[model samples]
Target: MYVIHLRYTGALAEIDDALEAHRLYLGRQFDAGAFIIAGPKVPRDGGIILAASMDRDRLDAIIAEDPFSQQRLAHYDIIEFKATRLAPDLNLPQSPWL
Candidate 1:
């Protein structure tokens, strides 16, 4: 699993300009099952994305497609981790062994 943390590097106006494109890109990723959950941060400065079922290289390639990356509106910090457990009601591909 992976947690993609994005921090805004550009001004809010610049970020807004590319928001739609970024959302469209996210939509495509979700459709392809490359992303599980995504949304803006509390202060609206950046965002977070939960992704799984892929390797780091593949995830990097996908992140490269995000408009934020293409426009240099944000910086991404990718953290890879192993899933150890989940709540009983939560279901994810990584839950198979749970």
Candidate 2:
């Protein structure tokens, strides 16, 4: 029900390291059923989008633990909003309504 948009602004050399951490973080979130979908932007854009829990506190905790934040590898600008609509391709097996 919430999406996190993250932007990376560090040296390009750090991308690989940053991605490793991101992968672990995403794995944890997925296993915990906190994150719905997450991935990097196309064209190698320095950004990623993560769809996550509806709870702001939970989302904030997850972001705080991000490797990008811990290693100072990237800066993040997060926006929290209700998903008023979703694409037909959107999948939510965990969602009660779904």
Candidate 3:
């Protein structure tokens, strides 16, 4: 599993300008099964994304295409980890986590 954290580095105006394009990119990634969940942080300074792991290089390249990234409006922190627990309601395979 992987978690992507984004911290805005540019002005709010700039971030807003790219929000739509960023959402579109997110939609595409969701459709392609690259992402599981994503949302803004509580303080709204940045955002978080939960996703399936792919080749690190590919993941980096894919993220680099985000409007925020393209405009140099944010910094991305990608963290990869092995999950060892999940709730039954999630209905996901336990093999990887276990």
lDDT values, one for every candidate? 0.87, 0.70, 0.85
* Model 2 lDDT per residue over 7-96, tens place: 677776787767887789889878877777778777554666555545667667777898877877767776766666778998664732
How are the candidates ranked when ordered by TM-score, highest leading?
Answer: 1, 3, 2
Could you tell me how far off, in angstroms, the CA of residue 61 lies in candidate 3 after the best superposition?
Answer: 1.2
Highest-scoring model, TM-score? 1
Question: TM-score for every candidate vs. truth?
Answer: 0.90, 0.76, 0.90
Native-vs-model 3 lDDT?
0.85
The model with the greater TM-score, 2 or 3, is 3
Judged by lDDT, which candidate is best? 1
| Residue 14 lDDT in candidate 2 | 82
- The true-versus-predicted C-alpha distance at residue 86 of model 3, in Å, is 0.8
Regions of candidate 1 where Cα sits further than 4 Å from its true position: 93-98
Compared with the true structure, what per-residue lDDT tens digits does model 3 show for residues 1-98?
68999999998899999999999999987777777789999998999998776777877877988999999999999999877888878854322222
Query: How many residue pairs clash per model?
Result: 0, 0, 0
Worst 10 residues of 1 by lDDT: 89-98
Which regions of candidate 2 fall more than 4 Å away from where they truly are? Answer: 87-90, 95-98
Residue range 38-63, candidate 1, lDDT tens digits: 99999998999998757678889999
The number of residue pairs in model 3 that clash at the backbone is: 0
